[model samples]
Target chain A: GDSVTQTEGLVTLTKGLPVMLNCTYQTTYSPFLFWYVQHLNEAPKLLLKSSTDNKRTEHQGFYATLHKSSSSFHLQKSSVQLSDSALYFCALSELGSFNKLTFGAGTRLAVCP
Target chain B: GGIITQTPKFLIGQEGQKLTLKCQQNFNHDTMYWYRQDSGKGLRLIYYSITENDLQKGDLSEGYDASREKKSSFSLTVTSAQKNEMAVFLCASSISQFSNERLFFGHGTKLSVL
Candidate 1:
């Protein structure tokens, strides 16, 4: 079985501030970690993903590194904007379990002016 | 690019009623999945199909049944609705057999049972 944990339930930040959303996972097999973002009134979309440990993956000004030893993949961004307000979900798919993703309770990011 | 379509963006049902949700994908993907998202909660796996006629129960499958009648379609049925139960059901598809394959999701069907 696989499970993911997102520590924050909600985060509020001023525009241009740095952002970080914590994510951690547990699995019996190898891990494939991912970040999914949902804009207001829209379906969740993939933001970034990686299975390679210790390697940072970035997209759309956000980045995350898969740390196998710590079982963490924390999402971060250097500067936040109003457009970055959304719900973020951290997920993991076990190596042998094809197409099954275990997701964390999402974190709601509110970027304020 | 492929599309995953989920019918009836919103669903309302009475308690104990049976409800069905449909999903179709044009990706010709080998795997399709159904996940439930409660308000402010994590997405929970309810069912999945590896290919045509193949069904698998996920962690939250107790009250649900699923079918893959064809390669492009997968459907989920709620055996009996619960009052005050409301959630969003999402349909996703991926091209590969590996679980790590990036999944494409539909807009999701919001369900409310009274």
Candidate 2:
């Protein structure tokens, strides 16, 4: 079985501050890690994803590197903005089971002025 | 460039009642999925269809039934609603069942059982 863990349930940051959302995973095989973002009343959308270990993937000012040894794919941004407030989910899928995804209890990020 | 559409943005049901949620995807994807999202619990798979006429149970399929009548549509039914059950149901689609494909999700259906 595969599972994802998001350590922080809520993260509040001032505008222009850096933020990191912790994500760790457990899987039996090589895993595909992903970050999805959801704004109020909107569907979740893919923010970034990576399967290559140690390779950093960036999108929309967010970046994550898959660290197989550490079993982590933490999402980070250098500076937070007011519009960056949203729910962030970390998910994982085994190498062969692409249709199934295990998501972490999302982190609610609030960026304040 | 395609979208997944879920019918009835909000649903209110009585305890023990049967409720159905519908999903349609214009992505022409080969796989469709139903996931339940509870507060602080994230998304859990309810059911998935690899192709038309196919149905596979997921982690939380105990109280639900699913049907994939065509490639573009998939439906889930709550056999017997439970009192105090409230969650959002999300419908998603992927181009294939490959581990590398990205999933596209629709605006979820919020269900409340009274």
Candidate 3:
């Protein structure tokens, strides 16, 4: 079985500040890591995904690198915007088990003025 | 560019009631899934279908049944609603279950059990 852990339940940051949402995962097989974002009243959508270890994936100012050695894929943004406030979920899928994705508890990022 | 439609944007049920949620997709995807989303609990998979007439139980499949009679449609039923149960049920579809395709999700149906 695979599992993902997001250390933060909520993160409040001022606009233009750097932010990082911690994410870690555990699995016996090769892992495909992903970040999904859900805004208020909207469904979750893919933000970034990566299967290659050590390669950083970026989307919409968010970036994450899959660190197989550390089992981490922390999401980071250099400068947060008001629109960046949302629920972030870290997910993992085994190399061949794309249909069975394991997701973290989720972290809500709140960007304030 | 396709859409996933989930019926009954909101659902209210009484204890011991059986409730069904419906989903349909126009992506012509080969896989469909149902997930339960609770505040701070993240999304938990309830059931998934790789193709027509196929269903596979997920980690949170207990107390729920699923039907995939058609490639474009999937339905989930809660055998017995619990008191004060509140969560969002999301429907999703991907091009194929075997590949690492991104899932396209519907807006989700909010459920409340009294």
| The best candidate in terms of DockQ | 2
| lDDT of each residue in A26-58, candidate 1, tens digit only | 998999899999998788999999999999999
DockQ, Cα level, model 1: 0.81
Can you write out model 3's per-residue Cα lDDT over A25-72, one digit (the tens) per residue?
999998888899999989899999999989988998899999999999
CAPRI band of model 3? medium
TM-scores, all candidates, are 0.97, 0.98, 0.98
Ranking by lDDT: 2, 3, 1
Q: Give me candidate 3's TM-score against the actual structure.
A: 0.98
Ranked by lDDT, the better of candidates 1 and 3 is 3
**Distance from true position, residue A65, model 1, in Å?**
0.9
Report lDDT per candidate: 0.92, 0.95, 0.94
The top-ranked prediction according to lDDT is 2
Model 1: residues with Cα > 4 Å off, grouped in runs: none
Q: Model 2 chain A, poorest ten-residue lDDT window?
A: A93-102
For candidate 1, write residues B1-114 as lDDT tens digits: 889999889999999999999999999998899999997678998998888999989899999999999999999999999999999999998887687788899999999998
Give the CA lDDT, 0 to 100, for residue B82 in model 2.
Answer: 100
Q: List the residue pairs that clash in candidate 2.
A: none
